[model samples]
Target: MAERYGVVPTRRQRLPLVLGVLVSLVLLAWLLWAAWSHSTPAVAGGLTSYDVVSSHQVRVVVDVSRQDGDPVTCTVSAQAEDHVVVGEDDVTFPAGPARTVQTTMTLRTEREATSVAVTDCRAGSGGPGARAPGR
Candidate 1:
């Protein structure tokens, strides 16, 4: 018989190679899903309105929602006309009957605040204290 001219994969070798490719594809898919999921925010909410009660105080209202009914934490901030952060506070919401709740927070500022908003929000598992942006 003529000798084989090319490298032909044997059955044993082919089995391992096919399995390796399948495993690699599965791992790649998992990694892609994890990256996509983490890149998006899990919490949903926004600032409803803000009122400057006084030169040193601001009342901010936010509507927060989590489908899982889990508690959430929010950062309320007040900014002066110059776009400087005058006041900031971390407010925690305990688990309640409603998944969506409107929260009112009061922030004390060093000077008058021209605008206020809810800057960031996350799940309650973030623990106590404030969350700096990008955390």
Candidate 2:
């Protein structure tokens, strides 16, 4: 032999490297899937304003963003000064051809409320994709 360039890796020595590569590939695939699944939500909304109409009524204005034509249901709740839930209602609407919609809901409460909000929103008339609360 003239001059050996470099020693070839033996099968035994390369086994761990191959196994590590396989394990890393598997982990990377799993991470990609997890990230993709949670990248976007179906429904989201927020309370724009609220008005205390009377001792037993509240008017709430909200802005909702969602996929077009996806029927979404949201829960609006009225709370008293001590953060007690004094009224609640389920409001459902379709985004139609728009991605955002502004709505107003009037709730009759059992007592006076200091604040009103959209607590949760979900996609589809068939239930929901996922619940995003406190939006």
RMSD of each: 5.4, 5.6
Cα error of candidate 2 at position 81, Å: 1.3
Worst 10 residues of 1 by lDDT: 126-135
lDDT of 2: 0.79
lDDT of 1 by residue, 12-117 (tens): 9899889999999999999999999877766777888888999999877788887676778887888999999999887776666687878677778999999887
Candidate 2 lDDT trough over 10 residues, lowest sum: 126-135
How good is model 1 by TM-score?
A: 0.69
Evaluate model 2: give its TM-score: 0.72
Per-candidate TM vs. native? 0.69, 0.72
- In candidate 1, stretches whose alpha carbon ends up further than 4 angstroms from where it belongs are 1-7, 10-20, 39-42, 125-135
Candidate 2 clashing pairs? none
lDDT of 2 by residue, 1-135 (tens): 225677777999999999999999999999998898777776787889999999999878878788566877888889999999999877777548878877777788999999888888778653443223222
What lDDT would each prediction earn against the true structure? 0.80, 0.79
